[model samples]
Target: MKTFGGPVLFLDRSDINTDEIIPAKYLTEITKEDLKPYILEDLKLSGFDPKDDKTKNARVILSRANFGCGSSREHAPWVFEVNGITAVIAESFARIFRQNMFNCGMAAIELPKADLDLIFSHSGQSDAAISINIEAQTLTMSGGGNQKTFPFELSPFDKALILAGGWVDYADQKY
Candidate 1:
């Protein structure tokens, strides 16, 4: 299974779309690796630079609701996978986007608004990071001398997809 969690990149906005995750112009690239370096290149958030070290090093993304909005494309998740981002934690996700994440063996974790508020409080701190334990079904956020844990659930099929390392691998084993 893909490892999840590490330094968190907090995107303090909602409705972040696929085009922002990866500009559509690069879609014709030959490989997922070719799509790297362009992830989030078009995202226009105050104080967020796509080229920043924070972007390059983040292994998990924390964002507000409606992440992965806009077009339904597998390339968005491919970009994140190439970037070594194993998970995205948000208030909610676009349905297709959430499925696509699991299809790629990545976590699309949803937390209630109150829980998100608590987690967002720890964001932007230099030491902010998260630890995800899928088997335990819990997310632990720590930074600024504070820590919090929250529980989340996944459907049996979704859990199986993640554990088996995505749909293709799951099929390879099951069928």
Candidate 2:
């Protein structure tokens, strides 16, 4: 899997659900581009266009506890993928969302709330950087000397999936 690196955009809170990631109404039959506009619409509560907010450069998303709760819609991860959110760092995650993320080439990192607070509380003005070295099993948040290490439980298949650029591409390669 590609190491998660670059700037840290901290969102400190809890109970961010799948529906909040991608509203249930859009779950019906939407193209990837159509779904992009609704990501974080429910939670960010910002009427701004979701597509405009999240792009390839918005590398890391840091959040609080139970990060992907509520319904297990595949669309949740789909929305993240469409909007170019590569990784999410949270205190904890719903089991399904975690799996879905790995399947879709998105890295979900779990860390203690205290560690989360340190990163989030760093500053609002400067552009801070966060790096995750999978080989080293460490997470370093730059600009504040706050660093922590944690275990990531990824199945071999999931790792391969991520490295291959997601499940569909992985499948196409194998079969």
The number of the candidate with the highest TM-score is 1
Residue range with the least summed lDDT across 10 consecutive positions in model 2: 46-55
| Tens digit per residue, CA lDDT, model 1, 58-170 | 99999999999988889999999999898999999999999999998899999899998888887769889998989888999989888888999878888888998899989
Cα RMSDs of all predictions?
A: 1.1, 3.6
Highest lDDT, which number?
1
TM-scores for every candidate against the unseen true structure:
0.96, 0.77
Predict model 2's lDDT versus the native: 0.72
TM-score of decoy 1: 0.96
What TM-score does structure 2 among the candidates reach? 0.77
Query: Candidate 1, residue 63: CA error in Å?
Result: 0.7
Query: Where in model 2 is the C-alpha error above 4 Å?
Result: 1-3, 44-57, 144-157, 168-175
Candidate 1 at residue 68, lDDT?
Answer: 98
